[model samples]
Target: MQTASFVGFIRTLFYILAFYYIFKFLAKLFLPFLLKKVVQKAETKFQQQQQYRPDNSWNKTTTEQEVFYKPPTSQNRSSTKKVGDYVDYEEID
Candidate 1:
């Protein structure tokens, strides 16, 4: 019984080590994708700030609508016939 328990403990230890290394490997693979997404978002925000300048004496309405979605008019609605094509469920935040 003692020998069996020792073998089981070693097996559990090996499995834990394997899981740790597997997680590390996965993180290494996915970290670049996460960084790329963050960098792209930062670039977009920076560009938007430059483009929407309130101090530049521009007469544009600055009441920033966070999401600018064009509601489908009768002409567009008639053209779209798919069942799940033009449905907007989530709030446009």
Candidate 2:
């Protein structure tokens, strides 16, 4: 049968804390370098994909059609300026 002792308990606690701090320190030191390598790899992959992509000019077609707009000509322009009292009336109901 195994018996619990105060010394063993303290030793186990110290090991746990030591391991935790060591892991934290190592991660803090290496995480940024790992992330930078990952970003550079992704950028290189994206650039390679862009290089091999098909040209968009082949998918575009120029149409021979054209659109034109012209204002309508009115034969009597002076008659449109005449205003009467009916044009300014307001109803309150």
Candidate 3:
């Protein structure tokens, strides 16, 4: 049977606490700088998108007119004459 030593247990607990505080300190130091960079990048991308988008005011006036199509007039031909070209053939017996 193995028993855990009190000194080893206390050392592990102290190590865990030290790591926790170190992580908190690093996060506090670096997190805002990283967040500011991310926010600035997002803002620049949004501004670029806004700059490239077409203005809606020009489109608003043009959308009211509906287009009507007028097809070209064609000459009327007899249906029988236009059906198909005649071809001569013989039935095989």
Candidate 4:
């Protein structure tokens, strides 16, 4: 079996660092283009949805609905019951 050497270790480290930098550089170049496309697609989808949505103005009628409310009668009024006693507390410094 071959043994680990300093040269091999240095070569592996160099490869890893090179790959990392290359990937980072490529991402920086392409990420914005990808993000812009995604945003444009989303915007188009939103506009399409807005266009397809039914207009609320056409569905609304000019007729006014009258609402009537009657006050509670004395027979329907509930009696109040005492539930608990209140205790007053003084703060001590």
The global C-alpha lDDT for each of the candidates, from Candidate 1 onward, is 0.85, 0.89, 0.91, 0.92
Q: What local lDDT does model 4 show for residue 81? A: 85
Per-residue lDDT of candidate 1, residues 1-31 (tens digit):
3455888989999999999999999999999
Query: Residue-wise lDDT of candidate 4 within 1-93, one digit each (tens)?
Result: 999999999999999999999999999999999999999999999989877888756666878889899987768657588778898999999
Cα lDDT for residue 71, candidate 4: 88
Evaluated with TM-score, which candidate comes out highest? 4
TM-score between candidate 3 and the true structure: 0.53
Among all candidates shown, the one with the greatest lDDT: 4
Which of the two candidates, 1 or 2, achieves a greater lDDT against the reference?
Answer: 2
As for TM-score, the candidate ahead, 2 or 3, is: 2
> What TM-score, computed on C-alpha atoms, does each candidate reach?
0.46, 0.55, 0.53, 0.55
The TM-score ranking, best first, is 4, 2, 3, 1
Tell me how far the alpha carbon of residue 9 in candidate 2 is from the true structure, in angstroms, after superposition. Answer: 1.5
With candidate 2 superimposed using the best TM-score fit, by how many Å does residue 22's alpha carbon deviate from the native?
0.9
Q: Tell me the tens digit of each residue's lDDT in model 3 across 1-93.
A: 989999999999999999999999999999999999999999999989877888846455665778899998898876675768799999999
At residue 92, give the lDDT of candidate 2.
Answer: 90
Return whichever of 1 and 3 wins on TM-score: 3
